[model samples]
Target chain A: MNTEKILLDHGSGGKISHALFADLILPLFDNPELSCQDDGAILDFEPGRLAFSTDSYVVDPIFFPGGNIGDLAVNGTINDIAMCGAVPKVISAGLILEEGFLLKDLKIILESMASGAKKAGVKIVTGDTKVVPKGKADKIFINTSGIGILPSGIHVSGNNAKPGDQIILSGTLADHGIAVLTAREGLSFESDIQTDSAALNTMTRQIIESGCDVHVFRDPTRGGLGTTLNEIAVQSKVGIKIYEPSLPIKGSVQGVCELLGFDPLYIANEGKLICFTSKQDAQKTLEIIQKNEFGKDAAIIGEVTHTDPGVVLLQTAIGGVRLVDMLTGEQLPRIC
Target chain B: MSLKYVEEFRDGALAKQIIKKILAVSKKPLRLMEVCGTHTTSIFRHGIRSVLPKNITLLSGPGCPVCVTAQKDIDTFIHLCKQDDVIITTFGDLIRVPGSGSTLGKEKAEGADVRVVYSVFDAVHIARENKDKQVIFCAVGFETTTPTIAAGILTAAAEHIRNFCIHPANKLTPPALAALMETDGIHIDGFILPGHVSVITGTHAYKDTFEKYQIPSVIAGFEPVDILNAILMLIEQNEHNTPGLQNAYPRAVSDLGNIKAQKITSQVFEPCDAVWRGIGSIPSSGMALKKEFHPFNATKKFNIQAIDTPEPAGCACGKILMGLKNPTQCALYKKKCTPMTPVGPCMVSSEGACAAFYRYN
Candidate 1:
């Protein structure tokens, strides 16, 4: 605990590594299976199907407004499993640290992961840590893998979106991407925006427990809502028509996007999910989602159309229609 | 946060009214070339082509700095990256532009220290931080970007930042317009001038081109309403046979433009004969650092050599930029080329015509 910085010996599996595991990580993620010092967790559960999802967080800066890479990594996989209509149970954290990383900063990150697990009622059952030379990698990178138990007879997928189905967004879009963007060192812009990185398992559980014949659940993470909708359209072999005015966006994020010439439609999001449901159940599903704390800004942004299979269209707020194509290449900030 | 003027210019009713006006005034088939990459994107993003009358066609021009950057310049960047103790910093737009053997992106993946910077100041800061390494900025842009880069060089010189240098491939808008007008089989009725570049160069920059070509032209903003209104003006001018210049984007652009910025740009750099990707060499079109600031020129400082090379075979980016052919007409488009594996700069740059077509189509 008195170490000023992380050393190569900390990942060497010697006495130093053991002390790091025992003194730092183990107590924060203290659980029966993890404390046993086994290679992996041995779990016992009732007869059911389980969903397993893994994601890596290599976001630049690592720390941004509202959250750091720690919670973002945990919440990312948790949301991934939640999108599969399952209750996330446990997660494993993998940290790859640069040699000169500060132990104090690592503790802050670990504390964030522990609190994130506590909030979601999940346990960090197993983990690994590694250290590389100073120039081998960025300051820190985290990888999280999680397991979830699916409810009986739950069938939700990107392919399930049918014609006439309503598309519901869980909340406002593009917070996580904008937050990281504004927090970047060189390209920093002043904005009161923060990452909307949160556990979506509880909110997703509410919808599945409601049992209203939900067709699809997806987290629009890297490609934003526009690309995600295009994906659903292609997967379901249907066309989607989204209304621009109904979409929710914070004015500050929108302003930043405007200045940078970025379309919020293509920016990344972390704490939101899109649901496609039948017309009759759409109202009920939307209301149930709206009741959740994370789903406060939820709205039906679009609908699946019978025509133009595999295409996504946006009806502009100003009364024009434009095709929302799949985002191509890295969306760089524009000079014009 | 809700931008008032932004929302006003995007007014649906105003766009509809302007479209109606364009429809009523149009008499003959017209090909209007929007000379800015940003305008091309805005036009396609709003389905402007779909709304316009069948007779009127909007063409993407050679305005994208990335798309127009010569292959030799790109090769020079990759070559510099291969040298030891050198770091190449560039705008995101030029990172993907293909050279003869590789791109800056490919070199970076192969262990080169290639960095993507948003502005010239970022590269200067990188040089200041890494005193042991030489930082070469890939300076490629139009008037909107040149002044900023010039300012960065001035700051670096004042601070005596010896490690900081730039490989400037900067271009001028008016010269490129004239080059296009002189090309054979290039018949554009009117020009939709660049809004941002015009903000720096002003409406007066196009006066020479207008006098020579006598083509109806309007400097238009990137909003749907502004574009529609400009289209109506161009339609009226074409119908009346009054081929002249007008500034439709008066709010941001003026008669003289940003004089201080222009002055600084002139102080730091001078016009030199520059080769464009598909457009060949245009006299005094490219900007190079002045002889007094040779120390700030990366090519001179590092003794790097330019590799003269031709465009990729079957890539119709030049013709496409000239407005002689649409994106689909390119032999390699969506066949041997795509955004993922771009065969030309037009497909690589976000502001490129092929990229705009591929995205919105």
Candidate 2:
């Protein structure tokens, strides 16, 4: 793994990725599920319906505040499947590591991934690893794919958003982005700000079982709430309007965003999700989410609108309307 | 919370009207130079140039502290970080600033004693705590930060903190502007003086440049409208052949500036020849610790020799900072030097023109 020269064979889906995995990753996390080699593993469970989902993780600084690529990989895929009112059953991981990656770091990352997967009650069944040269790729990039079983008569997607549905934010926005920025830029304050990276499968399960009619579920990850709502608005062909004052945000996150000229709404999140449910069921959903450890600060942020199809608008705190556009280019830190 | 109605200062409608008035009055192409890096960032961030008339071409000057800091001086600070019992305290932006081989952040990761301090006073506080160790405050910036560093020096001197020292890279803004005006490479039509620095040094500091170069200079605020208004003023001046210093940010800056800040700064430091990153050494452009305050000088305390260090082989940061070339004109801008992995000081500082262009533009 410490060899200077990187070769294309490292990324090849043959013996090189396997050797790199065995020599670097397996010894760190010698787990039963990860040891098994197959296209896909079957989960033995009494299920009403199977909720299958997959995702690829490609974040810079492979390691950041609160969590790293490993935990993010496991939690991200699990949260995606769990949003469908499902319990994550089995998970698969793929690694695209650079040749000069440290063996010790890979061990730590895998251990984190295993711990995260175990906590969610999801086993890593199948996996593949490939390594590119040092300059050809970043230090480490992990891709995770998972499958879960949905409960009976439960279905959730972006298209499920309906008029009069209340939009709820799990916790806060811009925590992950600020944490990453602070860590990367070496900016420190008297207040200790850490990334709120965690698996939300348990919280999602609690919301679903609380007898609330959740119309839609999505995690505001890469493009934040703006992009996520834009996707839902387009998918459902409905208008989404959120209140700026109602959105939950930490003071430190707001301060950093203001100084750095970054928009908190478009900043990234790791352990947060947006749920759309009926006004009648919104109270029940909020109550259930608030009771859970991960969703303690959950709040009803906004609601869906019937006008202006396939668009997201934010009514500012000062009583003005602004279009919440999907983030473009790189989300550079700004002093707003 | 004291709200100052900063929003009203960015009125786009008023700015558009002002722009229209300036364009109607202008006779030829005008080149306005924004001396503050913050102004440069604001100009691009708000797309101010797009709204301005085609006759007005905005040029970025050497207002960025990181961009103007000499490569050799940065290397010297990096060298100080290598010392066993020394702790290098500086702003967060200076940590990632490239020196000879690596940056302070990279060196800190590799076991160098580097700490990011928000204020110069924090460095003094650190020195008091670590009595046995040497605390070297990497003092970098213009008039805005000089007073704070001066105050820290006064505090350290009064406390008799033998361990506290400062690597002074504090440079004056007006002298550098004068140096730029003297250079044949740049042909700036007017000047947009730094707002924050003007709040400390006063508008009077630029009187010499205005008298000599006859360039209309405005001390403009950071807001979008402040920049737009300053551009309008420049265009008007160019049309009427009126070249003098103007103040667009009267709320913070005055003709004389903060007297207390200037008194402390003058009492603690003296003018000296300073080398700029993109620009050559300018006499009386930088500040040094006063002889009575020699105990607080890091260069004297450590007896560190000033080693001549060259820029990266093909880096055009010098030309970029002088407004002779844009960041994209540099061959290594996006390819070899990036925000994540920068090879020059301009790309490192958040307030730097290159960083602004790379991130916002």
Best by DockQ: 1
Q: How does each model score on TM-score?
A: 0.96, 0.66
- Cα error, residue A94 of model 1, in Å, equals 2.6
**Candidate 2: deviation at residue B175, Å?**
0.3
Among all windows of 10 consecutive residues in model 2 chain B, the one with the lowest summed lDDT is: B1-10
> Which ranges in model 2 have alpha carbons more than 4 Å from their true place?
A1-336, B1-3, B11-27
For each candidate, the DockQ is: 0.53, 0.06
Cα lDDT of model 1 by residue, A178-224, tens digit: 99998988885766798999999998898888879899999999989
List runs of model 1 lying over 4 Å from the truth.
A1-3, A36-39, B1-4
lDDT of 2 at B43: 75
Tell me the lDDT of candidate 2.
0.80
State in Å the error of residue B21, model 1: 3.1
User: How far off is each candidate at the interface, as Cα RMSD in Å?
Assistant: 2.0, 7.8
